[model samples]
Target: MNSKTKDAIQIILVILSILMLLYSIIYLVNYYSENDILTHFPSNKKSEDTDLLTPNEIGDSIGGVLNPIIGITGSILTFLAFYIQYKANKEQRKFFYIGLNNEKQNRIDESNKNIDLEKKHHITNLKIFKSLVSSMLNYYISSSQNIKDFLESEEAKPLGIHLFIFKTDSSYEYFNKLDFKNIYDSIVYSFQNKNEDWENDFIKILNILNFYEKLLAEMKNTYKIHSQSKAEKLNKVGESITQEIGYVLSDNELKNFDGIVEFLEIVYNSNPDNTPVLPEDQFKGTDFERLQDEFFNKYLEKLHMRYNETANEKYKSQLDKFSFMNKKIGVEKFQTVAYTKHLREVYENNFINQTNFDKVQEFLNKINIS
Candidate 1:
């Protein structure tokens, strides 16, 4: 039975036992007095008043017989009361422990569920990274083969379209000055004047690039949840594509192209002890002066190591040089330099003020010495 009900029943039994004891004492006293039993108990006395015991003597005799019975009953009642209370306390303790165990089990279950969810999240991100990398490789392969085949063909030489013509100074705005659609259409139209096969090959390359340009926009959203290394590789591939195409076009032509600037801003903010002394941690608008200065500073820190290590003499010569540039820097440093520089020139420029130039000087003073 429940503890409460059991306690109530125990209370009733004790009360009833007390009432029965009281009733038995009252009934015996009345029966003895009414029958004149106490007065005749000795059997020698005839006169009622003289032979009957005194009131005090009768009271002592009654008490002598009843006290032991009452004591025994009281002892039994007390023991039962204690036993009932002990049982109730034991039930309460059991319930408490059961509740504690259930709560602990619930917390463990919740923790396990959270761990599973995190694992799924990690797996999903891995799949997304792999898929993006695969698409990037596909884009590279398809475009490269098409370009190579086109260049190797005799018909392509007549167009005077050496791939080198597509190369520009790393910071040039030759592509940004004009519209992408116009350039695309112009190239396609020029190909239309040639054989059908040439037109098809040129269109194929253009289509691949166009697809990648769209994919970059999507990567901006995905990269926020991915690892920094994956994002860095993505940024590198994007720069390589833009460099080979000799132009930043479409969404890539934006100042904060594909949110890459914002991403880099986060990186710079997260790393406070890094060697490069940034004037600011974020890009709020078209603050090209500060941005360009930071990029230039990173480039100088690289010491032209990438240019010297490159086997392609033409490619090495194409890199901008400074007396400060050399081969002592590491690959990671060169990548950081190149990536920052790419961010600076990927879009159009705005006029810089004297104050911006002063900020640039201050930034340079701090990092150049360090």
Candidate 2:
């Protein structure tokens, strides 16, 4: 039974015992008085009064009946005390068990937290190790003479014309001032003529590009695994590692590589004797029109910003290096059958920025077609 119920039962029993003791005493007193058993002893001795209880007899008679009731009441009180003690012990045991359970749960929770922390630390270490390895590989590749030369070459420096459009106005100016077409034609001629030195350098560049591509793919796989496993931190680490691997090639080199690959593909596959087609014949198309609209508008906007910013001292110093006096060449002269084909292919592959494409498109659009 519950503590309250047990306590109520004990209280009722105590009340009943008290009442029973009180009733027993009353019954004894009434019986003695009614029967003349407890009458005072007479000073005059009489034979008839011999049947009455004397003072000593009256005390003995009361003791005989009262002793058993007192003993019974004492026994009930002792049982009540033991019952209360038993209930107290039971409550203590229950409290102890509850405390023990709480402690066990706390230990389990602490262990789980430690395991999770260790797992995060391990993931962090792995990310660091992978990033270091990628950096080392990038350093090794970039340190090579062939790759270094390719990156530093004037052919690699023209960000414009490589991806059908220039990313910045400075690149277009560089292209015009450097007479990039002649340099490009010379490289193409070397490939067409099968120059061994140029071919070997090309092969080395391709190999390096391939290596970076593979590394990026591996990093992407790692990212996918972490994402699927629901490890958000690990996924972010993978993304960081992939980005690090991607930076193996600089923006300029990447653009140059695209142009080189396109040039190489044409030289190796096209008819060697094929005459270069006119710009109007090669560049006109619905797709080219769309590309022009998308790229040229944004380019013009940025070009306007660049013109306005030219008053800045830092910009003016940079602009002073390139002479703006040279007569600008017609886009038709450079937009040959091969170059047009390369542009279209690059556009289709999404290698060129559509907005930056507009920059070149706007410049080309403003040129007098003659």
Candidate 3:
């Protein structure tokens, strides 16, 4: 149970305990009061008159004894609820163990599936990179190598092709990140997959690379659940995650990411002190005017629908550079920049202005200095 449920149980236990205690006290007091009123005797003789019921009243007392018994039972139930609440609060946090149980198998299966997907992504990137490199290599060979020698020096030809493929694949768009796809693409060109003897071997290597990626992501998510934000252990978990995904992280590199993660974790763990500083924290003492202009121009471009939505709120709000720019920047003086105008400034001049755009720009420029 979560904290909220535990609290509710505790409260219910307390209320029931109080209610049972009151019921017992009230029942006894009312029983005596009614006996005095109905006895048809003076108040001082009420006990005497009630007692005079003698053998009949004495033998009719089973219900009187059972009333206290039932009250005690309610008291026991109240205590049990309290006990359960305490245990839930103290022990419910053992989610780590839960994950290690049957959940482990589930995560493994999930990891395997993800690995397969990553393998496909890696394979595709590699195929494209390999095809490009091989094509370039073959062109070079045809232009310079003797046709007789090309067919004869088969190993040499593929060797050159593989090197070129490795180099060109690194420059591809989606494979730039240090991900499984990136690693697979990087190593894939080293194999002579285009040759008839090599296709199956390359396919297996692709599968292995993908498996590593999934294993890494699952471990990372698990660590995030229980790891303290400021603990260096969390960073180790993150580093492990990256390494699992095929990044060649050095011990020192892991240390660096660990330090950053620890620092960020501290901010998060501090609760009420939440927000982490922007990546632009190092901008002070730099040339302000140049930075402002660069900020302004970038802000203007951001107003365009094609520009990306920046997550950097500080940069977006503080600079005032983009204050005039709406979802589009309206150029009050597009021609004012004169002969010095870059094509970029000329294009931004025609951006439209509107109410909502102006409102967001004013406050955003005040806060974001990026």
Best by lDDT: 1
Lowest-sum lDDT 10-residue window in model 2: 321-330
Which lDDT values do the candidates have, in the order given? 0.44, 0.43, 0.40
Q: What CA root-mean-square deviation does each model show from the true structure?
A: 27.8, 27.3, 38.6
Candidate 1 lDDT for residue 225 = 32
lDDT of 3 by residue, 218-310 (tens): 433433432232133323433433343232123333223322233233322212245434444542222212222443344344433222345
Rank ordering of all candidates by TM-score, starting from the highest? 1, 2, 3
Clashes of each: 1, 3, 13
TM-scores for all candidates: the values are 0.35, 0.33, 0.24
Q: TM-score of model 3 relative to the true fold?
A: 0.24
Off by over 4 Å in 3: 1-23, 34-71, 74-79, 82-129, 132-370
* Cα lDDT for residue 2, candidate 2: 79
